[model samples]
Target: MITNGMIAPVNLTANVNNLNQLQNKATPAEAAESFASFLKNALDSVAAQEQNVHKVNDQFIIGEANVNDVMIASSKAELSLALTSQVRNKVIEAYQEIMRTQL
Candidate 1:
């Protein structure tokens, strides 16, 4: 199972079962709400990482944090932002593709 702050092997069978349950139970409105909340949470996480980078850099300047910590924080923030940008691009592309469908 996916839990906080640790890496472990995922049970794909369990995950697929849970996903099937969600698909069966959720209405379109519920799905939309879920998607919106997910996007908001992801953006919030990205913002938090960016803020952490700044905080780490400040601490490093005062010799409280090490260069390694600062570098890692910066890298995490950069990667999160890049991932968010890519997701946005993919979502836009999917929407455009749907719009272009001749149905």
Candidate 2:
């Protein structure tokens, strides 16, 4: 029963209402805290992985671990650290870009 232009008006109104509701939900401070918590968790995970690698290396040194096991653990820890550094670099770059944007 509706024309295409009429449907477009209804869709636009619904989208605007949804966007308003989403904008009202969270303050900037809350969002910043959530992001900080996420970063802390990521750092904790990386540290845990490094600790596991150290344990594997210690065991290998004492002749209590298999060579292949130590090698795999070391590689995994190296990759995790490398990936974490890359993510950090990307985040910093994004922040810099945002700062440079004209308001």
Candidate 3:
């Protein structure tokens, strides 16, 4: 969530004596909605990049685009997909860890 080359600071301090109050900071529904929206946006961006690659490839075939454009688009799509996969893996790992916590 960087804006204008500046990263926003996050307030992550937790009151060690008030562990129970932490759960009230964000409702499960609100968290879910935000997470779902973020994931949908990320997936949509990746899909758009893939489509761009395809379009560039087709344009190159028709002599309307150069190899450089096609290559750049392909690389962007590849990187985005790879990043998405890594994020998915990390999310799965975090979920599994949370499931393993003792009550």
Q: Which candidate leads the pack in lDDT?
A: 1
Q: Candidate 2: where are CA atoms >4 Å away?
A: 1-25
State the displacement of the C-alpha of residue 64, model 2, in Å, after optimal TM-score superposition: 0.9
TM-score of model 1 vs. true structure:
0.76
TM-scores for every candidate against the unseen true structure: 0.76, 0.68, 0.71
Give the alpha carbon lDDT tens digit for every residue of 26-82 in model 1: 588876665566567667777777877787788889888787777777877787789
Full candidate order by lDDT, most accurate first: 1, 3, 2
Residue-wise lDDT of candidate 2 within 1-103, one digit each (tens)? 4332211111235434544554454788765665566566667766776787788778878987788777776776787799889998998999999999998
Comparing 2 and 3 on TM-score, the stronger one: 3
Model 3: runs farther than 4 Å from truth?
Answer: 1-26
Each prediction's RMSD over C-alphas, in Å, is: 5.5, 17.1, 9.3
Q: Ten residues in a row with the worst lDDT in model 2?
A: 3-12
Candidate 3 residue pairs that clash: none
